[model samples]
Target: MTAEFAVALPSVILLLALLLAGSAAGVTQLRVEEAARGGARALARGAAVGEVGDIVRRLAGETARSEVALDGEWGRVTVTGRVPGAVGTLVPWVLSATAWARPEAPGAAIQPAVDGTSREARLGT
Candidate 1:
């Protein structure tokens, strides 16, 4: 019995390590997706591009990438990053995700200023 147990212990450990690797990758993917959606929403609401990037970096680490582009009324955000797991030496794939959002309206993003005028007005139309 002892010899059989010893023979199976390595297999058990390897299986457990694989499970941990999968869990880590899943968690990283979810985090990246969340950051992408949040950043996209903020951008659609008129937030600065730098701010959107900051939000993604803060949530998903410095290696993560974020981009926002406008298509008339819609915005798309893509987030990508590498997630190393418990068995990084053996994992050969990259994990990534993307999300999209649309602006509420044309002038909806315009903010009112202290001078009783819209920011768009201050910007000269």
Candidate 2:
């Protein structure tokens, strides 16, 4: 029994550590995604390009690096970010999200048509 426990302990510890790291990665990914959604919403409302970039940068912070791109005419926004792992790996994982919204059309103008002849005359003739 003692030999069996000793053999399994290292593997168990490694498994738990990996699980914890994976959970941390998942949380970081969720944060990055939320930041992207916020950036897109701001940009869709006709916010300035610089303002949108600043918003994303502030949201991402040191944990994740982020970039925002906007298509003003189409009202489309794309955000990309990289979330670093807890492990000291040099290559950070990348994630991206995009959103778009179209501006509502203005109400149409109502105009009345005119005729050269008087209204009663035109109606009768």
Candidate 3:
């Protein structure tokens, strides 16, 4: 029994460690995706590229990096961050996410519906 226990212990511990590392990587990936989405939204709202980068960093981690591209009415943001943990280091896991949005012109306001009734008016707000 002792021999069997000794043989299984290391395997169990290694499995647990791998599970933790995988979960950490998944969480980091979610953060990267969220950062990209937020950056895209900010860019679509006419925010400066620097501000979008800041938003991405804030939503992700300080070590995270972002890229922004604007082409005509389209905007794209990509965010990348390193996963945290020894396993991540061993595997060199780098998580990235990209999001796209249609940017409005600077100083352009949201247009009302075709019937000329505002959303608030329809909702009685």
Best-performing candidate as measured by TM-score: 3
Residue 55's C-alpha lDDT in candidate 2? 70
The collision pairs in model 1 are none
Error of 1 at 23 (Å): 0.5
lDDT of 3 at 89: 86
Better of 1 and 2 by TM-score: 1
- In candidate 2, the residue pairs with backbone N, CA or C atoms under 3 Å apart (3 or more residues apart, or in different chains) clash, namely none
lDDT (0 to 1) per candidate:
0.67, 0.52, 0.76
For model 3, the superposed segments whose C-alpha errors exceed 4 Å read 104-125
Q: Residues 1-125, candidate 2, lDDT per residue (tens digit)? A: 99999999999998987787677667766666676666556655655545555676666554444443323344444555555555525445666665554433343211111332221111000
Tens digit per residue, CA lDDT, model 3, 57-88: 88998888887655546767878889988888
Worst 10 residues of 1 by lDDT: 116-125
Ranking by TM-score: 3, 1, 2
Best by lDDT: 3
Worst 10 residues of 3 by lDDT: 116-125
Task: List TM-scores for all candidates, in order.
Answer: 0.76, 0.62, 0.81
C-alpha RMSD of each candidate structure in angstroms: 8.3, 17.9, 11.7
Q: TM-score of model 2 relative to the true fold?
A: 0.62
